[model samples]
Target chain A: MDRASRGLPLLISRLDKDYAGKAGPRPVLRGIDLEVEAGAFITLIGPSGCGKSTILRLVAGLDRDYSGSIRVGEAPIRGPDLSRGMLFQEHRLFPWLTVRQNVALGAFHCGLAPAAVDALVRELLERVGLAHAADLFPSQLSGGMAQRASIARTLAGQPRLLLLDEPFSALDAFNRLALQLELERLWQRTGITMILVSHDIEEAAYLSDRIVVLEADPGRIRTVVENPLPRPRDRVSPAFNAIKARLFEALHVDTGAPFAVPTDPAPEEAIP
Target chain B: MSMEVSSGGLAPPGAAEAPRAVPSRAGTLSHPANWRRAASHVASVVAPVALPLLLLGLVASAWEAMAVALHSPLVPHLPEIGKELARIFRGGHFFGEMAVTLLRVGAGFTIAFAVAVAAGIAMGRQKTVAHFLEPAIIVGLTVPGLVWALLCVIWFGIGLTGAAVAVALSIAPALLLNILQGVRAVDAELLEVAAMLRLPLRKRLACLWLPSLMPALLGGARLGLSLAWKVVVLVELFGLSSGIGYQLNSEFGAQNVAGVIAWTLGFAAVMGVLEYGVLAQLEHHLMRWRRTAQV
Candidate 1:
């Protein structure tokens, strides 16, 4: 798709954030710096309270009370814009609206004619496999279906960058795996600069082009691991396991725990 | 990128088909289980109306027995009140009076709703607005409907304006409180989503704020309407020359027990229709999404 080339590179420098605690200003994020190339898939994986989601929120411009330089392409984000879309842990579909109406909200500012907007909504619903459930309210949908609709809503604006804050953490294993695959496919097709915050090691290994591991207690990036596995990575492949093993080592280094070597078992044994 | 992996175990096969196969037509009614289901549905629908009517019947019978035994002029027989009620319906004068009263109620309630919503939203959204309005709202809540009616009658004189203003003043504070609570309780997460999407203010109000406030709006309407009805009648009784309230006042002056009872019952019936027939149906339709959530 030609839109694949529309992704805008993001730059963040010297980012510092603080929260007003009872004692004094508590540092949440400190001296964070990262540069993401256009159309790259990046995952921020870390333990809880490591400020991964906070970073995503900052990049989305939902919270601007931070000392940093965050630029999408060449423009500094003043507030949320149509060019950047975000998905939360919860589906966040408006409970009062049907799937179609909720998705249409994303395109409300696109200045399209009503008919064109309708067609675009239908196309997005179809792409998300929610065409059958388009008229269903958020309450009626299963967890996975609701999240799919949310993805459709996020994609409706054709954003050049997408931020996901553990978008599938609430789902069952089966649904999580399904959505992960769906997200990977969407990333490949749209080539949107994507950033996901997750603590799931395998999830980070499976989807990220680069995983930025973070440490808590005045949160900052510990290391960035570049994935060597090719597209359509097999879960049981030796290379895939190696990358997962490397991520485990990086994560465990902060906790002062010895990294357990991953036992390379047969594919049949790995299926469990 | 493989489609095969996601296609399985996402949505169970035939899950969507189950709701489609529901037997909605009479063709499937002949089945025994379907027959039982239909009977149960009918029973549930009828039970609420049936129980109230049964109690009313018993009360009426007891009143009639007592009236006959006493044989007093003060306690008219049940049949006499029923005859008076029928006459009020048949006589065209009563219809005109009822219509005048209904128009006043409509005007007053509309004014109250508009003012309450405006003030409620302001108070709910801004801390300073809420602080400034809180004491006045509390005082408004404490004042009786009778005082408002009498004050409006004194100020506006014997006219539609007196009755309508009385009703609005008496009811606005309660409705404002209801709407304030709803606005304050709006989900913050959904709002963040609205912000992240860059939804315009107008769209946010329509899709998010208004729908989120609907239950409270409807609840306020129900309470406000009931209060407005009583206040409008009180204002009309003392000040206005034409209305159901005026007729009841005249009946009281004449010491006609049956006439007063008939007018009271007739007004109650109209109020019931407005509440159940109009407001209840609207609430059901607007809140259908919430009902589906429970299932």
Candidate 2:
């Protein structure tokens, strides 16, 4: 990273989020503080309901109900900006729109000339391998292809910060692997800052520069592990497996254990 | 219904695989695949239509048999009704009455639709609006078409205004309820996606809310149009000088069973054309996106 780009980090300081319940305001996220360096890939991985997605929501500026100071570069994120692109797990493409039209919508607020928007859409579609399916609607596209188009749509705006909330968790294993590789290539090509929320530890290990493991029950960041793997990571490599194992450990998974049902002790016996 | 269209056994080869969109064809079916496609298309079309036509035939035959067995003046045979229908067609008296009734339904339904859509949006968006407006809709639902027609006759003085108002009142509540439910059911996730993408408000509303409201909109229209037809007939039967309903009432007063059956069948034919030919076509076109999703 260059000196100028190095200083500008995506920072979250003392972040907190709550949901209103019959009892009171129930806290979802508590005191989350993290910094993502510019042009870096970071993954937030945790079990369900651990506020992994909430953190992305805050950065994407969709949830202003939360208490947090989220700064991208120097400016605070008060609301969603064109430069921060978000891709949800469901793809969220408009059913009525063709793939090209859906991708073109990413530039809807850009006010670009028609020719330029079309050119950008074409280029992005080609990159995502969805150029042939341009005229097809979301309902027509396969799950993987739809997700690829969604990624193309997000990239068409040339966002500086990309937020992905389990963008490929819905896909089969093969498509998921292909998309992860494609994502890495895009990141390398654009140098856009990306923060992904995923449950798949292997996915996080494969794509991220740093993996932030989170724990549920009043969600908190358990630890952030630096990934020292080189580019175009070999998933079968010893180093990659080592990092994956460490991530599993950070998430408090019993990696060595096989499937089993625990037997309850006698009623009078003390519980471990 | 969509499932019947989508899940046919001869579902095209592409359907079993990636479900690539079938290119929309025009009149010139040049390719050989187009012929098989057309043949399969015919079979698919016939599958739905054959049963309904058969059912209609059975009902008509049963009614004819009942008329023959009873030999009653009240239940005229099919031939008597057919003869009366032919006479009415030749005289062209039915057309004028039909036109007047249709005009009233169109005007009344338009008014009801405009008001209900606006009100539904308001009710869905604001709890206070819903609280204030809900009781009126609930009470309106409970009030029958006859009562509304009678009340409207007193209020608007027994004419087009009275009939139209009655039809609108009878139909609006159901439309409003459907629309309110639709509005409330707009996907929060998609809205979040729109916001996160920084899509302009116009684009968001166009691509998200409008499309999301389609099922509700169509549901309301189908209900409203059918209800408007019924209410208008009741209103006209009670007091109007001219309409299909008035003609039916006159026929009933004179004990002309064949004339009543002819008018009823003729009116139903027009409604069938309007519903199956026009509204059904519109629904098919608008909901083409749903075809593959069902599969």
Candidate 3:
């Protein structure tokens, strides 16, 4: 297949990033390669600071200072644009804004009229099934509702690419499952390309067409597994657990002391 | 660091809070929760008027007891002070004098509020500017108001210019501090959203700064107003031909204690009303949205 003949959008070639600190230069990521072509959910899973987030940031145009070039239609990435929206790990909803206002905030730089902004906010809120909580402030909302509002906020710009960075990590088990279902439904309805970064192997297996696993110690791609699991993904399904168990074993876990919060009595030297 | 009470019990923030079913307020006046809030609001207004009246009563009874003890005609009784208050309120010269003093204080206050808030916003945005302004604001805050009066008198002479300068010098430090704090206290995320949108100052001020600055700004304004008045009165006492401060001076010199008390009580009442009515109303209106913004 002549991939160029299809005009399939992707970030081609290796991505490199170096951390320049006051003390000295410390290299974080090197020789990273990824391909996210049209309308696909790409999951990048790894332990913390594996530069999985750095990759997403590079694609989103949030980080441009790097050794490699990211060619978006022959133009170098300059700054954040309306073509992409990102969801941070924390909901990051504006405390001063109601759910509706927080969602509308995404449309602020999009140059949309007030009526159109309102309509988009309403539509996204309804799609996320959080229309009932639209009037509530972010502080008044529950963990799930806040994340729903965050999703709505990201979607308000009508971006071609959605970057989700462990958005449902803060939720409980049941709520995370519901949010995953909601996200799947949203992607189905919108046909938007999403590159999600998560540490949860099951979540990646359930949601992504393919999972790209990166190993720790200045991370690099370790595995790319095509998840052939059927939709309406059930956690109790035999094949589902089989895939989950396999991914879980393959997961580096990196419980290497640093991942554990203090008060666990882990040896300090065992970390990073 | 602090405990917040929910319907069921106390809980810290950043915890999962489930909504609980609870009955309505017990009664409009009898409800322990909002009733206390309502009563406090009423008391803030009522206390200003009641305290002075009761204070005058107690002072009068003491003065009467002292008059009898000393056999001296110096200390005036409650009735004498009431008569003096009646005279001051009705007398065109005294009322006219208060109006003049108020004009000077008001002018200085408006200028101080404008400069302080603008400086605060500018400083908040630029670290370099804040670095320079920090030392100056601290100096102003620590310097005595009397020194400002003396300096202004030398610079502007003993007139409205001198009076206005005195008042501004007295309040500029405090006003600057509050305005800076308001700007500093504004949520960084909200500011980020505003910047991302490229919002204009008016929109930013209306939608962001006004709500964010209300409590601090109002608090600053109240202090500025009171401090300005004191500065104005002190200037008038030292230099002006006519004002409440002048009246107090003349009354004290003539041993008319009743007249001096009358002027002091009258000035304190005016301060109370300005605080409760003008400044507090602005605070309430500006922070109305904030009341329900977060849990």
lDDT of 2 by residue, B149-226 (tens): 888878988788888899999999999999999999988888777887777767877888778888998999999988
Candidate 3 CAPRI level? incorrect
Please report the candidate that would top TM-score against the real structure: 1
Clash number for model 2?
0
Instruction: Give lDDT: candidate 1, residue A99.
Output: 93
Q: Could you estimate the TM-score for every candidate?
A: 0.91, 0.86, 0.76
Instruction: Please report how far candidate 3 places residue A133 from its true position, in Å.
Output: 4.1
Q: How close is candidate 2 to the true structure, as a TM-score?
A: 0.86
Error of 3 at A176 (Å): 2.3
lDDT tens digits, residues B1-295, model 1? 3335535322332234221223455658779988998898999999989988999899989989999999997889998998888888885867788999999998999999999998998998899999999998999999999999999999999888888889999999999999999999999999899998888899988999999999999999999988988888888888988888889999999999999999988888888898889999998888877634224
- TM-score, prediction 3: 0.76
True contacts kept of each: 0.41, 0.41, 0.08
RMSD of 1: 4.0
What value does the interface RMSD of model 2 take? 11.6
Tens digit of per-residue lDDT, candidate 1, span A35-92: 9999999999988999999999998988999998999998998998889999999999
Residue pairs whose backbone atoms clash in candidate 2:
none
Ranking by lDDT: 1, 2, 3
DockQ of each candidate, alpha-carbon based: 0.43, 0.28, 0.16
RMSD of 2: 9.5
